[model samples]
Target chain A: MALTQEHIQQRLTEKFGDLVSNFETPYGMLSFEAPKDQNLKVLQFLYDEADLNFQFMTDLTAVNYPDKPGRELAVVYHLHNLRDNVRIRFTVYSDINSPDVFTASKLFSAANWMERETYDFFGVNFVGHENLKRILNVDEMDYFPLRKEYPLEERTRIDKDDQMFGRG
Target chain B: MTEHHQHHIKLPEGSIEKQTTTLNVGPTHPATHGVFQNIMELDGEQIVSTEQTVGYIHRAFEKLAERRPLYQITTLTDRLNYCSSPLNNMGWHLTCEKLLGVQTPKRVDYLRIIIMELSRISDHLICNSIMGVDTGAYTGFMYIMQYRELIYEIYEEICGSRLTTNIGRIGGFERNFTNTAFTKLEKFLKEYPAALRELENLFTRNRIFMERTIGTGPISAERALNYGFTGPNLRAAGVDYDVRVHSPYSSYEDFDFKVPVGKTGDSYDRFLVRNEEMWQSLSILNQAYKKVQEFKGAEAEVFHADVPEYYLPKKEDVYTKMESLIWHFKIVMGEVDMPKGEVYHSIEAGNGELGFYLVSDGGRTPFRLHFRRPSFIYYQAYPELVIGGMLSDAIVVMSSLNLIAGELDA
Candidate 1:
């Protein structure tokens, strides 16, 4: 049987029951958020559940929502159940201050580099990541460049200018 | 340090020991091809382990996308997978269309399929021929390179750029496919199969080539899935999951083509899978072209969908008409505001699933855009792939993975 959105929603609601909330079908994709602490449990359930085998990790990345205070960083995981050709969006929010989330590397090895990249840009600290220094930016880069506070380099800006950083 | 970049060792602390010799595959070496490289720890000829480092040419495209308007970001997507840039271009456009809830005409989708398949052929040709070169067969590389140029000529005819073609707009093609482009497509369809078959004979049947690649760098289907493998790499492992088939983007469902699979996912399996995919792409291209030729009268003349608000105006139209001038100016200057939506769209890029995840806040620019680059994802398994293999086999497997640095770093 093909996996439908309601089936996925029911499976999640039954398994975790309100632990996952904001169940929405954004652009025909089942999207919901799990508690930051229970991310792995949710992932494990979604994986181990024979009918809900979303084993394939399509993408892993974080979005910096500057307006949201406690939930500043939204770490989004796009998972695919290849058996049923069904896709769902699983997200967990973390505070920019703490930004600690459980790493999915243990479950999905693909999450290793992606988590590093997410750390490199958004400063979303994976609490147990094996090596979480930097992936794309220089190691000495003190600030996460993708955060909304550090706007993209512009000629009009006077504070922290390019010449000050030796980029000029 | 010339000692395999001690600065770039990404391995865990205790994994590397003192006995094995460390060899640099490349950040610039000719054999590695792209800017990314791996530091292999070899016990004589056998690779004990590898630590790979990437992002030497990091352009911060995702960060840059935060400020640019929707249409302006096409140029950024163009730089992702330069080998099959039109695929990236089309992928971005489709993402934008999905977010905007714009339905593209069937004719537009067919035209896009034609361009996309041509790009797939070009990309797979370069990769397969490069694999041949790595296996010490240089003649096959040179033999099929001209056919790749023919594919490029087709791209040139349509988009006026050989590489990094920002081919189509959000709605559809900037203009209709010209007669020259169609002529070039016909020429490619006529000549490429024979060349491809001979290229196959040169590598597939040769005993040396078979021996070198047959069991080298094999991965099981389970491990590949765990490591987020897709495209020909995953299919080479015998899982026939293709984005085109599974998701059916841009009217891919309208046509019928087989998704080729291979057992014992190795360099040879990857090579065979890519070669077969090229044949299937050719068949799709033929069907799309024929479907395009079937459009008649008013339907034939239509190119871009009737989304003037998003589609860029023709140069002549912008020059002549005042309304066209305003819309063009508005689009170019980032005055148009996109609807608030989150959309993830991926296409079957030549390498694998090249996905674009866009989140909009009903602003002039995207709040966030992430490229689910297949090169970045699948290339993570390189260390696992090269472990316990001969040092020489690492080079062939790397080329077989077809990691384009532009996409990898992005």
Candidate 2:
């Protein structure tokens, strides 16, 4: 039997019970948020459950939401089930100051470098990561470059009308 | 030197013996084919362990995509896995289409499949032939280079430029496929198979090639999945988890093709799997072309959809129609208001699942855009694959993985 969105929600809701919240099917993909601390527990449950096995870690990256004060960094995990051909988006948010979450590298080796990249960009420190040093940027680099504060350009050009573009 | 020093440090009588040699295979080594460092600890000729350092070619594509509008980001996608850039280009367009709910016509879909499969063939040809070159057989590369050139000529006919061809727009192609393009496609279809067969014969059954790659750098299906392997590398590990089959995109469902699988997950199996995939891609390309030819009259002329907001207006239309002139100005400036949505669209590129996770804040530019690059994910498993293997075999493993540094460090 193919896994349905309802079945996944039911199983997750039954296990996580009020822990996992914000269940949504944006663009027909099951998206939900788990508390930053209990991320591994939710992932392990999803992995161990025969019916809801999302073993393939398709992608792991971080998103920085400058507007949100408390929940500033969101680490998004795109997981896939090859047998059933189903994919789900799992997300967890942490404060920018204490952006520490348990690393999924123990369960998925794919998360090792991905988490490091997340750290490199959005500065989501994956707690318990074996080698969490800067992967992309140089070791001497101080600030995270992908943060919203860092503008791509200074925008000093006076040639074109800024109102013509969306920035106005 | 063995005597214990009391207060003062004594100089060693002889140089200290280092057991293992740390070898840097590349940030620029020819075997790597791109810029990325692999620090391998070796005991004589056998690898003890290896650590990889990427980002030498990091252009910060993801960072750049945040500020640019939809059409402007297409060029960035092209530079990712430039071997099959059309695949990434289409994937980005498809992601935007999904977010905006813009459906493309069947003719457009079929044409995209043809272009995509051609790029796939070219990419696989390069990878498989490079594997042969690494394993002491350079003749296969020589035989297949001309055929790859023929595929590029077809791209040139469609889009004007060859490599990094920003071929397709959001809804469909920039223009209709010309007669010259079809003739070039026919030429490629007629001639590529024989050359591909010859390249196969040069490497597949050769005893030396087989012995060199058969047992080197083998990974199990379980390990491959854990390491997030996909495309030919995962298939070579005896898993048939192709993105085309698993998640159909760009009317891939309309075409018929076989997903080739391999056992033992070694360099040789990877080579064979890629070769077979190229054949399947060719078959699919032929089927798509036949389907495209079946369209007649007005249906044949439909290159792009009726997306007045997105698609650029022609020069004549801009001159005559007032709305067309305004839309053209707006489109050029990238000022169209896009609906807010988060969409993850992936396509089966030459390598694996090239996923685009896009987040829109109801603005012209995307709030967040992440490319789930296969090269980046595959490179993570390199150390595990080549550990304890011969150094020469590691080169074969690298080529077989087909890790492009542009995509890897994106």
Candidate 3:
């Protein structure tokens, strides 16, 4: 039998107490928010515990909310348990000043590159990564591209007279 | 030298010398089906490390999908992995269908299974044959390529474009399986077994081919799982998991086939797994052909078929009926309200678990979409797989892993 959202909420609340926060959308999905410090604990439990072995980290992405004051960025992790075919989403919020979150690389090695991609696009720092460098775009890039505030249109105009020309 | 210096650092006495060499294998190389680059660090004939730099074929698909209407994204899905775009398109449509809470008819489901399995056969054929080509087995490559051509011909008969076929619609297929497609597929089905047998007999037991692939790039099942390996890569590691059997989307449940697993987790085992899977796909095609032949109908949905909100409203209906005209205008103007929710739908795409996770916030476009691509995961394990193998064998390892650069970069 598949565990419903209610069972997930009850089990999580009973296990972790106030460390977890449940956000219920109008849709049936229950977005579970755990404290940044407890992210790994929550993930490990989800993987090891009965009825919630979310062995697969389906996707990892970061969303930027520039308008939001306290929480300026959110890193979302979507996980799935192949056994029961159950899925759950976990998110952690951080502000721009020190936008840092625990890395799940130790739990799932696949998160290494994915977390780096998220960091490259959204600038959310995965604190424990050994080599936290940009994976997709070139280095020395000034800004994160995927943030809502960053316009997709090119913001910089090329200067015709800036570069040295080929000489005879 | 001092005792401390001897333990920490040392250098051999030699005259200062500089050596420079470079090798470019991409952008037009036959091995690279799409635009891809690999800059290799070399020490003479041996490669030190290879840096794969992609995105040359970057259509900016994710950004394009955000800007375009839901249906328009289907065209972009065609660009994700052009060799097997039908499966990618089906994955996108199935996600949308899940969001709409709509199900396709049983016949349409069978058609989807048949086409997708055919595409899988073609993809595996390319991977296996390309491995042979890279390993200098030209005859095997030609034999498999011949069969692949037959599959593409069948595809062209069904859809105008053979490579980038935007075949599946939001709720069902754009059209039924054409009679020509069915006949050609049936013919190919009968002949593919013999061709596959010939290739198998030639390569599977060949001493040279075995030495090139067997025990090369060996990865245990535990390591494969840790690295998030899927598709035949995971199967080669002795996992008995196939999304078709586990998830059973479309009419996969109705199909009678076996999920072939491997004993030794190596490139050779992966090759054997895909070889067995080809025969299994042939069985599926044969069964679907028999089932499709027995059916006698218009070959598509009837009442809900004319869904003006989702599908295109017919010209005749629009001219004759006011409601049809109004709904048509609404749909055309992008005023129809889609439900605000997220749907995660997956299918056993040719490679592996090709999942499309779409979050539609009651708008004309999805708020967020994610593709659970298989190559992306498998490529993450590339360094681990090829670290100890010879430089020449990297190509064979890559081919056995079936790393499609388009899908990986996308």
Query: How high is the CA lDDT of each candidate model?
Result: 0.91, 0.90, 0.75
For model 2, state the Cα shift of residue B28 in Å: 0.8
| lDDT tens digits by residue: candidate 2, A1-168 | 999999999999999899999999999999999999999999999999999999999999988899999898999999998889899999999999999999999999999989999999888889899999889888898989888888776568677665556576
lDDT tens digits, residue span B1-41, model 1? 45663566488888967688889988998888889878888
Estimate, for each residue in B1-410, the C-alpha lDDT of model 2 and write its tens digit. 69986898677977767699999999999999999999999999999999999999888888888888888899999999989888888888899899988899999999999998999998999999999889888888987899989988988888888889988888998889999999999999998888888888898999999999999999999999999988999999999988888788878888788999999999999999999999998899899999999999999999998988898887799999998899888886678978987789898888898999998888888899999999898789998899989999999999999999889988
Q: What CAPRI grade goes to candidate 3?
A: acceptable
Task: State in Å the error of residue B267, model 3.
Answer: 1.1
Rank order (by DockQ, best first): 2, 1, 3
Better of 2 and 3 by lDDT: 2
Q: Which candidate number has the best DockQ?
A: 2
Output the better candidate (1/3) by TM-score.
1
For B349-407, candidate 3 gives per-residue lDDT tens digits of 77788877676767777666667777776677776776545677776787788877778
Chain A vs. true chain A, TM-score per model, equals 0.91, 0.93, 0.86
lDDT of 1 by residue, A94-126 (tens): 989999999999999999999999999999989
